[model samples]
Target chain A: MQEKQKPYAYAKSLELFARAAAVIPEGIYGHQNPAFVLPGACPYFADRAQGGHFWDVDGNQYIDFQCGYGPVVLGHNHPEVEDAVREQMAKGSCFNHPTRLMVDLAERLTSLIPAADWAAFAKNGSDVTTWAIRIAREYTGREKIVMARGAYHGAHAWCTAYPGGVLDDEKKHILSMRWNRLDDLENLADGHKDRIAGIILTPYHHPTYAAQEMPAGGFWEGVRKICDREGIVLIVDDIRACFRLDVRCSPHYFNIDPDILCVAKAMANGHPISAAMGRKNFRESAEAVFFAGTFWSSPAPMAAALKTLSILESTDAIPKMERLGRKLKTGLEELGQKHGFRVTASGPAALPYLTFDDDPDLYHIQAFSRHMISRGIFLHPHHNWFICAAHTDEDIDYTLETADEVFPEVRKEMES
Target chain B: MDEILRASLFLKAVLPLMEDLVDFDTIAASAISDKRLILQFEVKNGPSSHLRIEGGKIRHGIGMHQSPDIRLTFKKPELLNRMFDGEDVRPGLRKGFFHLLFLIREFPKLAERLQYYLEGDGKKAVDEKTKNFQVRIGLHAMLGGMATVASDDASLRSIADETPFGTLLVRILPDGPFGTFTKLSHNGGYIFESTFNQPVRHANAVMEFAGPDAAKKLIDGALNAVTAIGLGQEIKIRGLLPLIDKASIFLYRFGKIMGV
Candidate 1:
């Protein structure tokens, strides 16, 4: 890691952020909000991006492990996804009727995912997740929906992680079960009885400022059994960990069958499209549910999804991403040990988060992340980091190399 | 606006923050350092609380104070709330006339000073001392007001009804000015407990400002939470963050109550 003569600065990024603040809400809002990362220490805006890396407005380049917060699984601007997008755009994008590419993409998903018998398209993860919930409610004629506590399904009023501007009535029917706690889910189902419409859960718990949690042993089996007994619909929100875990969807990796599966990020490799695929029996309910976005029939992202899925299947992208994620995790853990830090690298290899023992407020990790950002490595301090297929051995090595220098400084700061 | 809730807020939350004013504000401290005054606010058929200013310290007592130097009695909770809002709806005097004069003249100044800090009036071109007091008073008022509103307001209570039972800890790092928002399961609402300085413990969620400067910026709304949290160790939030996230809505509502 080359140390700059002067301290690193984001002159242009800050200027643009200030300008954005005057006109925009929170300067940048939602998950993409720069507030989620180290603002002054990290770049607030990107100038351009290519495979595995991006350049900030200040001309500082970074190995971006965030992968656009999980949408860019194949990495930024993959030629195949780009080319397919271009060809479809030339044929025009939004249309009154569904395009052939939409059917092609749906067919591709239904073929790949064992649980998906039919698929519907949307413009975002929230669109499909909300649609899935509504479809389940319509199918069961029940009002209650159970979800894992702290699991983010979407930004909809009923399921939003934040409470700002949301009403109590909007969430009265929504109940929460602790993640990996099969008994909690079972108890919720028992308590709700015939009123449970659906149970929506992220494939894995990837909460912010915390270590990600995989389903404990028999967790999925217990959930399936309970849902089966209660006649409750099980909806898997695989939006964040979709293709990164498996090309066939995360349920396939976990060996759990779900009634409906929603996917968005990494589906089209950065294209703005999402889908909800359900079992054949629920197709009628899915149809009955009113879910429409004007651009749902957009052909370009459909083509992009088609190509992205193909590339994911043809190449060893998934395995490569898993391997790279393992290397980064292993290397980071080793560096933590060498520097007298108790670091735990959590979640599946494809998508990982790092947490320090005894640092509940994440001071050490934030400090480490600040050091990493100044060294031009973009590992988020709070959120789970995505591993894209485009990240190379060199990128991982450089990241480790940067960490080797950073851990000691962070350790020193902890002591001070 | 529920006048009863507003009255509860004034009696339970807002007036009690005078303790913080004396504890943090040097001028307010010196003004009351030599005084021994016990003033009681009695809202007929509603809430009753008292403020005790004794020897450089202020203590708040709930209900009647046994023997108060002066008692200001409101005909209804609404008049008390109206008086808090600076209306000419004076309370009926129940006791000492000189103490009533103190309440008439000097008490408004304390309330005005508290308003100056809580309402974001002293954010610009202020010295470190003013900023420190502002942050201290603002944090207490915000959290205290949140607890009061969560318990007293019907709309806010519904929001609290769904909030998962947990404790949220908020503090500035390396000591001084810390508070905890604990959602009690039995009550189905949150209670905020803060002290001048104490080590945080047993919190389900924690939001820590790195220093007084960061705390000041966030409390004053000069730096939005997003930017403050993003400032790399400036504001570190961890544990059950959804607990904090949910409670933050009340904190936002507290801002609205303060007219920020």
Candidate 2:
């Protein structure tokens, strides 16, 4: 028997969102759109965050599991990362020329990533991803690029999941293969032949509103073989799972060698920075491709990234996140069973998601998410929930306790 | 905008909406309650459609009727399109001069009323009944418009051709209106086989608006489709989302074509 808890209210957040809606498009846009959450059941805005927790505008506190959709890996407003950012900001961020910090970060990435001999900086995952595609095209002197269907590389025209404002011309040269299907990849590569410039894929499939999938056995090996034989570049878009999977990068974690790698999200612990790292063979092609943004040379994020990487390397945060994530997943599944619901927790422990076994319409999971949010744990209903290094055993215990109370309520409501 | 697509939408989508308009709107239904006539409008060597009005009900379909009481012929597709677009273009009457005159005199009022409701102009004081009528028609129009454009427009036809065989079910929840668009076949083309007012047992995608207000906001531009969908429970889009996403883009292009 568990005591029912009062749901967190969002009067202030709603008030602010109403004001925001009049002026801003969709009140909050992109991945953080309030509509992505159970709007009335979840807070629409946040006031402040620290470590693994954040307080909403209405002053209700939550154990943050979303981690700003994979960006706040080290944690929100981490003191060390912030201090590094401040130290760089003291000497100005953007400048007339490339900062020394850029070279240092590049060198650090090139040294750390086994396949990367050089790195170029950018401001977003999309910037580097689109740039990496161009580099592959330049290197292979081809037009078509193959990607796993439903894999999100970025908001760029070539890979945006949404169809708004995108032209068929932009996607004409792009091809798709089903994830974890070596047959699909082989067929696409065989079908397109020398016309394919590259095959871009994430370390694992993390499509929204569905269970995440790891690379099946020999899937990566088959892809690597196909790329080598077909003269196509192998690009690993590790933006969502970069540091969370491995300190080196996801490719290193999975033991797959890629010619080009795009890293972002957790790169600078929430700072705006991304890097496209590539092998020495594509160096001239990378330079030949025109890729530049106004904020590409900014130094503050580079400093933060350097410190973040240092902390990731020097500490046992990666293993800690994994251990905590495992505990949470096990506890959640057990609780779901105890309450007569079959829950399936999928993906790597560090970046986990759970869905009801037979709830394709997602009604049960959505009700479950609303219940969890009511209990002050911020797990997204649609996307995979991130487990930051800041999360601890106490947070996991509290989450499990809340889910224990929630699972019954969700089951009862859904059954009704 | 392509003239053929526009003409197709006007013939297939817009004209078809008159059925729901008469069924839902008391004024539109009463206006023709005593009337029973078949009015056919055809573009010379191009698209043609006829509307049947009987027993206070309106039903429309593509191509000519066997024996229409009234028939009006347009020299070209643009003439019919411009006529629907509110230009004062008159077509040559081939039959039933009195019936054609009756349509010419009575049809504009019905069209204006339909536009007022679909656009949610807020010019007139709206009751719950009228508002519901507006939402029902808006959903039908957008979906019918999408099906028409997806089948006819070159861009959307290519998309439709690429779209795998599947069905998209859209409904205003807790009762009332429903629309289902099915990609009947790959090269066989698409059909907006709307099982309106009926719940589909299964579909590749199901986009449910929580209530009429949510549906109204989405249809009237008070809320964007993506934003409404983001509201999770307010608007639930589940299952094969790519089909819904592509259908939304077709609906968007249809709205652009309609200039509303």
Candidate 3:
């Protein structure tokens, strides 16, 4: 519980940020925006990362739990994944046609994922999700799609996190219903009938800045039933939660089969590769849909993915991460109780979230997160924390002990 | 008749159908009650018309109204016809209905409602079956919610040996309409034994829904449970404090099952 004496120095990072701002739109763009982290505590840039820890630009070191917003499931610079990528890079990255590695990876995916009869590669989660939607539309000859409201599919026009540039016409074909609402989905399907092409959703609702929600009992089963009855394609967007939940497939853990499964993030353990795996029924439409990217057929990420999947299946990586995550969750809950605070921990063990039941504005959470960051632990107040296989028991223990120490400071800040 | 008058007459003809299809009382309870909505329809090279809706009533007239709540200017009669025909209206909007911002903004729901009235009996028949489906599935959700509320009831504890932790009694009060007693028992992860006309005797917990329609909406995913309990004020739960949280989890899970 002893606090670190050194305050985080960000002079070098601030200088780099100013230089990047002159050229880059917001200096550091996307999710890595400095505004997303504590204004002063978190460094603006990461110099390098190894194992379960990362160092910021100013040479400040911390145990990283964000996992690069969900890639890096095994850890930063995993030897096997890196070695595979290195081998592939030696030959080449991309070509006019896909390399043999593409076929190998596709075969591997089909062998593992229950729904995957055919596999198509892409560069990001958005690419695969958008392609899956297109395939659904082509297969069913339907225009409308149903998605859970607030579910982050990707940064596509159909389901963008931001609405600045997206047009109304872009979202016209998409209909939204509350997550885990079986009745609503049924009504929507019944009301729309043959017009609905597909219903896409995450395995669970994990919206930003809120408590993550796990699927309730019979929820996935009911969804499968409705999709089967309605003849609408069921799409599981497991980009963020893949691998972390199950080695075979995330949907397998839920025991519900989807027609199309979209995966990314941890597939190659930080490689820029994504895939849309479809059932046999969707084979024709998947072929017909015009889904192609230049770098999509690159062998490097696919090579990494093959190695990563093989390692994941062979080793105790997922189980160890789950154990570590559970330990962290239990310790946080106990600490919350001791501090006379009601804490809500949700989602799967490997991907968990901690939030104060009573604090909606996240003031205490922000203060506590900042404290954690300052004390060499990288956890986000508004985002679910990730646990990788690289994390050791001592790392988790250090994090918990740090959290216990910071709870009082958080309480005092909230009181003030 | 002029184009405006003709359109007005069409609106009047569909008023009854709208009433039959939409539950105004329920809509009023949730939203859109005692509020005035004016829809101005503009036609190119033709007369314009305005429709006024207030408190579940509809009236239409020729010419435009200033500062209308929603203004829809159709560039072509075919576009409006396609909307009334329940055809996908996006094509029409993209074709030239740029001025019809509200229609474009709302899209299918507004156009689809008009199509529902236009399609007449076929649509009604399908809607009736959908409503029935809603009721059937909704009943399950109601039972589930009630079971959660009464998880720790003495009656539930008595039957816990037989049904385990999941036991429920749904009592539809006669005050609103469609009063009936249903007993739901869970065995081996599946729900079994739904007995009707059975009294609340030997049941773990009891839940009262305002009416069958309310229950249908609640279960149909048309109405949120929390909103039904809070704003709608239609469902009443009587159970143990600790059991309430447990019931909420059950109800939440069941609601997801019913809706998803």
- List per-model TM-scores for chain B: 0.83, 0.90, 0.33
DockQ of 1: 0.32
lDDT (0 to 1) per candidate: 0.82, 0.84, 0.69
TM-score, structure 3 vs. true? 0.62
Q: What DockQ class does candidate 1 belong to? A: acceptable
Candidate 1: stretches off by over 4 Å: A1-7, B2-5, B17-37, B42-48, B55-57, B61-77, B90-140, B146-191, B197-248
**lDDT per residue (tens digit) for residues A1-416 in model 3:** 22465446677777777677667765676567554454445677799999899988888888889998888989999998999999989988767888999999999999998889999898899999999999999999999999987688988888864434566678778888888899999899978989999999999999776789989898999999998888899999999999987997789988878999999999999999999998998999988988777788889999999998998999999999999999999999999888888987788889999888886545567777888888889898777889999999989999888889889988987688
Q: Mind giving the per-residue lDDT tens digits that candidate 2 earns over A144-205?
A: 99998778898998887655688889888988888999898888887887899999999999
TM-score of chain A of 2: 0.97
Q: DockQ, in order, for the candidates?
A: 0.32, 0.31, 0.01
The predictions' CA RMSDs to the true structure, in order, are 4.3, 3.8, 19.2
Clashing pairs in model 3? A181-B259, A181-B260, A182-B258, A182-B259, A182-B260, A183-B258, A183-B259, A183-B260, B148-B247, B156-B204
lDDT of 2: 0.84
Local accuracy of candidate 2 as per-residue lDDT tens digits, B1-260: 57877887888778888898888777787778888999898888877889999998998878889999998898888888898877888888899887765777678778876776766656666889888888888887777787777777766544665554577888888885888877775345445544455567778777888999898877777787765554455577755555776788788888888886
Best by lDDT: 2
Of the candidates shown, which would achieve the greatest TM-score relative to the real structure? 2
Expressed as tens digits, the lDDT of each residue in A83-189 for candidate 1 is 98999888888778988887788888899999999999998889999999999999999999999876888889998865568878898999988899988987888
Per-model TM values vs. the true structure:
0.86, 0.88, 0.62
The Cα error of candidate 1 at residue A332, in Å, is: 1.5
**Best of the two (1, 2) by DockQ:** 1
- DockQ metric, candidate 3: 0.01
